[model samples]
Target chain A: MMTFLVRRLAIILPTLVFVSFIIFGLQQLLPGDPALAMAGEERDPDAIAHIRKTLRLDEPIAMRYAYWMAGVVQGDLGISLRIQKPVGELVLQKLPVTLQLAAMAMLVALLIGIPMGMLSAVKNGSAWDYGANVIALWGLSTPNFWLGIMMILLFSVELGWLPASGYVPPAEGLGANLAAMVMPAFVLGNAIAAVMMRHTRSAMLQVLSSDYVRTARAKGLYERAVIGKHAWRNASIPVITLGALEFGQLLSGAVLTEQVFSIPGFGKLIVDAVFNRDYAVVQGVVLCTASAYILLNFLADIAYMLVNPRLRS
Target chain B: MTALLEVEDLRTSFKVESGRFQAVDGIDLRLEAGRTLGVVGESGCGKSVTALSIMGLVASPPGEVAAAKIRFEGRDLLALSADAMRDLRGDRLAMIFQEPMTSLNPAFTVGDQIAEAIQRHRGLDRAAAWARAVEMLRRVHIPAAEARAHDYPHKLSGGMRQRVMIAMALALDPKLLIADEPTTALDVTVQAQILDLLRRLRAESGMAILIITHDLGVIAELADDVTVMYAGKVVERAPVEALFEAPQHPYTIGLLGSIPRLEREQARLDAIEGVVPNPLSPPAGCRFHPRCPFAEARCREAEPGLGPVGPSHFAACWRTPLP
Candidate 1:
């Protein structure tokens, strides 16, 4: 297990480097000039040149990439051209909110998706199963942004039950933070829950029909025990993999949700940085999100080994 | 002495898209204490279904099991509530299946699987159940029982996994052990060893055994009384020696002939003429008429009931004696 983890970490290093290079390359290809964006409609070419020189935008693309790469390795994300502040410090301030939102979204997805999936499998072909399938289909088809808008209109505007937008740190108090997060989390989680539900249901159906499950039933175990102990554990392997992938997606894919909710998260920060031609912030956020995706996939492999004894050796 | 399990007029059917399909049609079986009753048949002949019916393991809605009477230990098993039947299972009645590789749960240790049965029926705590699991493994002649008990099913060979299954079935000291093609998936040597283990266990425990198999050689080796089935119905039944010696039904004779004999000078082993009929649409009269060599017009016009031919021997056929 130790060796496995070490090998995974080794692979992650090259992947992160490649991802950072891509982020830097893509930023250079953007149409707008960072210096001009910073100068903000100034008629004088002198002000633009001064801003470009100060921001090192006058250097060759390869040279600028090398400089940014060196800074990234040393834990310096450089300074935002628009805000004139350290990109690392700016991201760090908003990182917790994104993390909290993603975590909450994942929690909601799992808590509802797994049981509903199991129920659909156990009672396959029944009305309850059909109902779950229909609900999952709707969730999958509906875009998160549109869902977020509807939820805001219903819960915040119509019912006046929750705040329409913005975020509150948990340090301020758990209740207020949860209240502010509910709609965005639900919107983001619904799509993932739909995907997970389908995966889990199919996995469980396959496992439930397995010979071992029959043996479990023939052993005189209660129906619940047969499903829970034998079927569910085996089925969870695929579901866990799906869950980790969805979590990685949730971390980076919350751009629209964060916008609709007006939450100060990394996704929103990155989008804002892109429009302002803040090259450092975009590169930093992309690198972090890509690294998170790799880490999650590695963790998922370990989880598979844990869940299935057949894979351990 | 009374029989350990007496199943009379047992019938099991399934609901298919077309209509109801009878898998086991009007079967009668009796197993006495300390005796071994071997049920021999081809695939799809209801051997496994009979065992599942007796164990109440048959799924409902799509499948239904009905009987005139299914009495075990002087109580009607068919009349018992689901919970009552559950209590009896793994305690008074236990079963082992064909494929050891698929039957044992792969995620759990062999010890844990056996211990689960012990804990469920015997109410043993975890530690005590583990100890009993090791003992059960030892009883099944698995080498290094203590260490092997902790190994998962995937780590064990097919034979060892079957032995572990046997240990699990016998962990609660069940009064009746139903083995469904227990050695079908095993190698020849492993099959012999498993049969020998079962024989020894029965002699030691005095538990009645109902062994299901398609191999007549296994039936000849382990069975005291034998029941031969064709399609979904029992074609012949008798004491092991009588059934082999004076087998009346043509189907039974075909089954016995299909077995390759070392003493015979035949160039090729004989096979039953046709495949077992599909249960969804079996022959109108006799299920085996299509495959029987001696089948006559009357054989295809009407089904025959099991009738006495000799002492402790019964055969189902239109004509009792060959012309």
Candidate 2:
């Protein structure tokens, strides 16, 4: 197992390096002058040139990439050109918020979706199953941006139940921050849960028909035990993979949701950086998001090994 | 000996787009303690369905135990509530399925799965259950039983996994064990071993067994009595020796003739002429009429009821020759 972990880590390092190189190259390719943008429309053309040189924008792509790679290895992600803060610090400030939201949203989605999925599978052709299908269909069909708006309008504006916008760190109080974060989390997580529940239900349905489940029933196990103990565990590897992918997606794609709910997380941070042509912060966020995606996929593979003995080999 | 289990007019069906299709038609079977009844039929002949119906595990709706009276230990098994059925299963009755390779849950250790049955049905605590699981593993001749108990189903060979399945099924010393083609998935050598293990377990525990299979060879080796079914209905049933020696039903005769025998010199092995009739629209009167060479006008017009054709033997046919 240790050998396996070392091998996975070895593979992950080269993969991350490749991703960072690609992101660095692509950000440079985009038609944007960060120095000029930061200096604003009133700035003199000569001043823009001096700022660009200071930021090393005049360097060849290869030299710039090599420098950025070195800085990454040395834990210096460079300063945000617009904010005048360390890119790492800017990311760190927003990273925890995204994690917290994604974590809470996943918890909510799983806690609700898994059981609902199980119920749907067990009930199969019943009204309850049909209802779950309908909800999931809506979830799959509706765009996240539109859903976020509807949730805000319903919960914050009309119901006045949750805060319409803004974020509070858990340091203020865990409950207070969670209360503020719940709306956006719900918006993002519900969309994810719909996909998850469909996968969970199908996986469970497939496993339930397996011969092992029959053996469990023949052994006189209660229906719940047969479904929960035998069917669910075997069904979980797929659901876990789906969940991990969703977690990665939620981390980066909750921009519209965060904007609607007015929370300052990585999603909003990246969006702001892109608009202001803050190349350093943009590169930092893209690199972080891509790394998270690749890492989560690796974690999902490991989780499959842990959850199902059949996959351990 | 008083019968340990009795199934009367046992019928089970599945609903399809066309209509309800009977998988197990009106049939009766009786078993006594310490005996094996081999239910023989080709695939889709409803042998597994009958077994599942007996266990109350038939996937309802598209599958249902439409009509049957299953009596185990003088209690009406089919009439029992779901909760009561749950209690009876694994405690009084257990089942080993076809494809031992697929019958054990792949995610759990074999020991944990066995212990789950022990803990649920026998009420043994975890520690005791684990000990018993290892003991049962040994009973089934799984080498290194103690270490292998922690291994997952995928870690075991097909033969060993089937042994684990048997150990789990027999853990609570069930009164009856339904083995649905337990040896069908195994190679010849492994199949022989599994059969031997089952016979020994039955002898030592005195449990009645219902062995569902298409292999007449298995029936000859392991069964005391055999029921030959075709198209959801029993065509022949008798003591194994009697059925093999003086097979009365034409379907049985065809089946016996089709199988290659070492003792018989043959120009060509006889193959049954046609497939088993579709269950959805089975041939009227006798379902096997379409394939039976001896089938007559009367046989095609009227169904034959099972009746005594020899001492302790029964056959469903219109043209039985008298002694």
- Tens digit of per-residue lDDT, candidate 1, span B229-303: 877899999999998888898988888898888898999888888788988888977788898788889888898
Which stretches of model 1 miss by more than 4 angstroms? none
Please give the lDDT score at residue B258 for candidate 2.
Answer: 77
Clashing pairs in 1: none
Candidate 2, pairs of clashing residues:
A166-A262
Per-residue alpha-carbon lDDT of model 1 for A82-144, expressed as tens digits?
A: 777898898789888988899989988997788889999998889989999998999899999
Residue B3 shift from truth in candidate 2, angstroms: 1.3
lDDT of 2 by residue, B1-323 (tens): 66888998889998888899988888888998888999998999989899888889988767878556788998998789999999988888889988888888888899999999899977888999999999999999999999999998888889999999999988999999999999888999999999999888888999989999999999998999999988888888999999999999988888889789889899898989888788888888888888888888988899998878998898999887654
lDDT of 2 at B284: 84
Q: In order, what lDDT does every prediction score?
A: 0.89, 0.87
User: What DockQ values do the models have?
Assistant: 0.75, 0.88
Among incorrect, acceptable, medium and high, the docking class of model 2 is high
* lDDT (C-alpha) at residue A61 in model 1: 87
